[model samples]
Target: MPNLRCCSSSSLSLPAESYIYQLCAAGPASLAAISSDNSLRRFDRSSLALLPDGLVKETHAAGVSSLCAAGDGLLATCGKDGTVKLWDARRAGAVAVFQADKGMPLLSLACNASSHSIVAGTELVKPDAFVLFWDTRSPGKTCRQYVESHNDDVTEIQFHPSRPSVLLSGSTDGLVNIYDTTVPEEEDALVQVVKHSSIHHAGFMQDKAVYALSHDEMFSIHPVTSADEDDSHADEVKAVEFGDVRPVLKAEYVVQVLVDAAGSYVASGRTSDRSLSLTPLVHTPEFHFEQSNSWMLPGAHGEEVVRSVLFDSESRTVYTCGEDGHVRLWKEEPASSAELSSIRPTKQRKEKGYKPY
Candidate 1:
């Protein structure tokens, strides 16, 4: 069975009465987080120690909502103050800022590594919601604005890891839309749509599949097939719901869904319970729930809701941040040879109070 152990742990204190909302692995040994106190802080990945002179305090006038690690030592963040800021991780201030019209609240953010474009989603307004795009090289100017995609608040947005022109956005209206950003017009950019009850987060898995987490604690995976040359089969190109929807963490909500760097496992952070649960993706045909090789890291946040979990597969380490304004580190432990050899075979038997049906 898979073994996940908490080998060592450390915590870092942020500004007074701060609440962390998002966390991202900035580098192999470093992490970055955004908080309700309108601050962005960085820490050592292994020790969870606050890096001296590694803070950008009050960069946003309001609470920060989301964070992402852009390429080349850059960090991207969006805030309720209706702006997206790009910061150099080695420095203490923002290098560029992207603003929205009328100072609309920016709730979600994503950065495209291939095209060097930044996308920001807005909170719900009376008539419609919008997704703003900007070129990273030429900041402070709007490249395009998509206003007809979602009807409610835009909750999450992500760019395809391998495809530079593809983008994904999810909203509280229970719709997940995929768009081809290369198209010049907003009306012609939409490629597909996947509907659910209410979406909390959505992201691509290895470029072919997309996974979505709902507010009701359910998860679903969809498969995207290649388009057919024949026009008669064009409708068949829509994403097909591929697998059973299952409860991920059995909590009120799942803050985030994270896949390991090697794509070997998937994990989720649970609210109210303060735990991180992991499940191996590669399983045998005879796999049973009792032998599924899954484990939980309990007492993860100590009565606080864990907002984010980041994994480093190279070193087999995990980092988590929470509402308590603390970042914690967990390392895997290998089982001993003696402990494995001591196991004895068990005899199969029926339950004590049951009979054959």
Candidate 2:
């Protein structure tokens, strides 16, 4: 990967001092973000200027917890208020709300445009937790819900990049469950489960392989046989466990393993040196991280945790948001003759995989 350098930084003036929680490419030229201040806003992707009619204050009664692209230039956000709202960036307020029968805080969300579907995972409420589904065409009522797969708050939910009905959910209960939503029965819906510890982020990476990152930084990748079918069993799927990534990445914490146009990259931060590293996940021949291919950015957010990282392929720039309440952009530093000569193409090694034990 190219050595990324900080180019520009922008700050969003929310109602109060609040952390920028999530960032997503809203449309062609706009970047959408949600915050702890219970608001949603858009900014120019190039200049990082706040766009006109782009600010929507108090999007949720409490605070927005998650944001995801809902297709057709729309954005979806859910919050402690327990409802999912769809937004058209050109407008000021939510266009529609996906309501749940019981108002429970939602923690994670995922949407599929091809299937006209949206899924939201709720925080554990007494005896039950839920993964509610709604058809984008009809947002007034939830269409389906899975109540038995997870016993704790669902921290992440993602659909197969190409297979919408194939869903993945990870939770505080240390289980990452894969389900075929087309299977109406809750028991039958759950086809696979991978064990972990309090998952912070889990999703479909390249080739639809499932990666689960725990809150304490335990990372692992579970491979699937094929993407065409969703019945792959968890017992058969051996996980390549990389326990406690803080040592491997030489960092204080692992932020997220985000997949962009290129592939999945692990974002990590080292507070002692105040640096951030993006290690590319190479899975072509096998699964491994090319640390030599990592792009390091020093003075990263000044000791604050970076929450989200977005790589724009068109501009070839990196955008990162953090607890510092700022969105910073980084571009490739012009390589010197010595630096250019030192750069050699890295290859994925056929390393042995670790079981999820």
Candidate 3:
């Protein structure tokens, strides 16, 4: 019902119901693409062409659940196989396999800028989940040991782009913890811990909110500055209710959230119609567009579950894919009439079942 339309459409076919678990842009042109559905497949940005380079077989013994690209054409994948693998994307060979706690599946991975060390997080099973720090410098070194971290299944992990020592992770157990890799022995010395729902996605935004996408269309914008610091919390929230909690903005179901480098705009993807809506952080209460573009990519796998959306700020090009095996690329444009839909305000808020405090 939202003003949603595909800016353009292209489709691809795949062998199975491939849910995109991870994505990374290759080369400086950002013209190359890599994704994990059944296996790692490379695609050409122009003409939505499937390139000859692809990992036909699944990355892990079970299935590839996550992926990340490090510098020098290095790639990492983790999944039900309970192992983390490092690969040379250009060479088409695996360099090493880092095993997780026996039987525990690796769900997520984050790489430092150099890609020498990787931080891996595992899915929650029962009593707890763990995050492992791996040294990938020596590919010949066969053995690996995991440092137990977190009280529940680690849902996601991320590394500070400039600082390798700083790491961030969220878990189903409602904990967001920061770790200092420099002190590998200090297992529980968290730089910061947040009590909230499992974080689906997270990234630093203008030294302000740490934007994250939860399971639902819900998006949480956590103010980076402490609540004790009023000078930082400027925007007044409209829809979502918090007991003076300043991190969250509109608590609607959001599949993905990305902030441009300049922090001028935030793009949050909506899963329902396969589109992303843009919200301006500078304007606060007035979010300009909702359901901006319908993402359509040909040569996609089955199912159409959107895996990830990567934005090239310089080019304003957006690359996204889902279970529908193919990845779609979109170029950003000004807000069209198709983006402005009627908002009942209070009525829609009530229908959302917002708890009035």
Highest-scoring model, TM-score: 2
lDDT of 1 by residue, 1-357 (tens): 434566555445666655666778787678888776777888887667778877787867877888898888888988888889988866658889998878888888999766989999888977889999988888886789999999888988998776778889998788888888878887778878878756777877655566666665456666543222333423322343423223433443355556533553345445455566655443122111222445567777766666677776566567776667777777554653222111111210112211101
Checking candidate 2 for backbone clashes, the offending pairs are none
Higher-ranked by lDDT: 1 or 2: 2
Would you give me the overall lDDT of model 3?
0.52
In candidate 1, stretches whose alpha carbon ends up further than 4 angstroms from where it belongs are: 1-3, 7-11, 225-252, 264-274, 281-291, 334-357
Residue range with the least summed lDDT across 10 consecutive positions in model 1 = 347-356
Least accurate 10 contiguous residues by lDDT in model 3 = 341-350
Superposition TM-score, candidate 2 onto the true structure: 0.90
- By lDDT, who's the top model here? 2
Better of 2 and 3 by TM-score: 2
Q: Candidate 1, overall lDDT? A: 0.68
Against the hidden reference, what TM-scores do the models get? Answer: 0.83, 0.90, 0.72
If both were scored by TM-score, which would come out higher, candidate 1 or candidate 2?
2
TM-score of 1: 0.83
lDDT of each: 0.68, 0.78, 0.52
